[model samples]
Target: MVIVLKNQLRIVKKNIRQFIENITSLFSSKISDLLLAILLIPYLISKVGIENYGRYVFALSLTLFLVNIINYGFDLSAVRELAKNRHKPKMLKKLLNKVLSVKLYLTILMLVILFVVVFTIPLLRVEKTMYFFALFLIIGDLFSLRWFFMGIEKMKYIPIINVGSKLLYVFLVIIFIKQSEDYEIIILLEGIGLFIVNIFSFLYIVRKKRIRIKLISFYKVKCPVLK
Candidate 1:
């Protein structure tokens, strides 16, 4: 009886360790992301000045609004699949392909509509049209990569990449912008920074996981039956 109890305790301890590791990984990732945002905002404001910063914020808000329209709650579906089949490559690939296909199409459509709005809408006071273009790409790429990571349960990488990118942006901002008047350039720099970082990270994941970008043939992959 004592031997059996000792074995049970060992099992419980092992489980506890695994749980702790998962939680720690997630916590570290989230903390890094929050820190990046906190640092980037001040750097942006200082470099861009108040008026330009306000314009940047408005552009970002509009980008977010458009992203939400394309997403249509598909993020939740990806998360559910990732949780259920983290270890199954085939399942993960299928779900990811489906989600990516839908997102890609939606993103293209949104870009077209946004291009018209930015061009026609006089209220969007965006001086550099390239800045809006960069903003759209950055937001779309980041959002898609986020869903991919969440599904795979490899979220530890997200914060590291996000924070590292922001840090690089800070360095670039200081190096390039000597005057506060260069707000348009600085804003464009910020967007370009995010775009480059996300692209690198996304490529890394694809290479590491050997994920092939194939067209999803079937409309539906069997999802896990929840209890």
Candidate 2:
């Protein structure tokens, strides 16, 4: 009886530790995102000028819309799958890979569609180039390593990477804005920053967590579809 009680207590303690770690990591990452957003708004507005800033914002809005269309709610679904099969690392990996594969294919299709729309729509013609390039941001957000962290519930590293990347981006933006007032430069910076951050985080997860998609391992499962 005492042994059983001790084992339960130990398990509880471990869970609590993990919970605290995840929370702390999330907090750190959010703080970084908050700071970056705050700094980016002023820097972007000031560097690009009000008129160009509005155009940039419009392009960004379009990019986000396309990103959502491409994502088709797979991000949340992947996380849920991971949570459901937390005990089975192999299963989680399979699920994650399948979802990722689907997302990648969808993203490519969306990009092509968006490219067509950007060229065909008269109103979007002026900002077409910018919007096209903005696809990188959408891809970055979709493939963000943060999703994997959320799935595995080992979120401590996410915030660290997220925050560090945002800070580095902010620094780069400052340097660029100091030298020029080109709105395209600012927009490019934003897209590139997001790409770099996501890539870095994804690489970190792959290297440290050994998260990978094995095409043969994935089995058909009714994954919860999120809207």
Candidate 3:
């Protein structure tokens, strides 16, 4: 019985180590992202000039607003669901699919509304492409699946992937942006880089056993209205 107890204690310690590691990965990713943002902003402003840069910022804000609408509280909610139902991979897979589908529908609807608002507003209409490209940031988020990794306590090392992608974005900007006309590249980089990292995160789940994905009936889920 003492041997049994010793084995169990070791298992518990290993689990604790993994959980702490996951949390550390999350904080490290956040800090790196913050630092990257700080470093990139000045170079971007210098390249685009104040006026164009200001316009880009405005466009990002609008896109961010729409992104939040699509995400809503799914991060917390899905994490809760996973935490409760974890251990049952089959069930967790269904819930993940349902949540992703619901998010996709919301994203499409929100995009439609965003376009309508952008086109209808005479002032915003001029920068419609910029606003629309920024939408890719959110679209890329579809693949992030952060809640999945968080719930699983795997974290999947976002800091490494995110920082790598951001560095590429920085490189692209430095090489391409010599004038105001190149300002559009900024949005493009955001879109492309976000997708790259998010795709990396998603594949980490799908390819490895880090997490599982399965098809499930949407009707089984009582998804909130943009469902």
The top-ranked prediction according to TM-score is 3
Output the better candidate (2/3) by TM-score.
3
Number of clashing pairs per prediction, in order: 0, 0, 0
Candidate with top lDDT is 3
Quote the RMSD, in angstroms, for model 2. 3.5
Q: 106-198 in candidate 2: lDDT tens per residue?
A: 677778887898889888877666776677677777566566678778787787767665676677778877622466555566767777877
Q: Residue 86 of model 1: what lDDT?
A: 78
Clashing pairs in 3: none
* Model 1 agreement with the true structure over 41-130: per-residue lDDT tens digits: 787677667787787677767776777876766668667767789798887776667776666666777877777888787776345464
Sort by lDDT, best first: what order?
Answer: 3, 2, 1
TM-score of 1: 0.76
The lDDT, on a scale of 0 to 1, for candidate 2 is 0.71
Off by over 4 Å in 3: 4-8, 209-222, 225-227
Per residue, candidate 3 scores C-alpha lDDT tens digits across 80-158 of: 8787877887766676777777777777788888889989999999887777677778788777777776777667566
Off by over 4 Å in 2: 178-181, 209-227
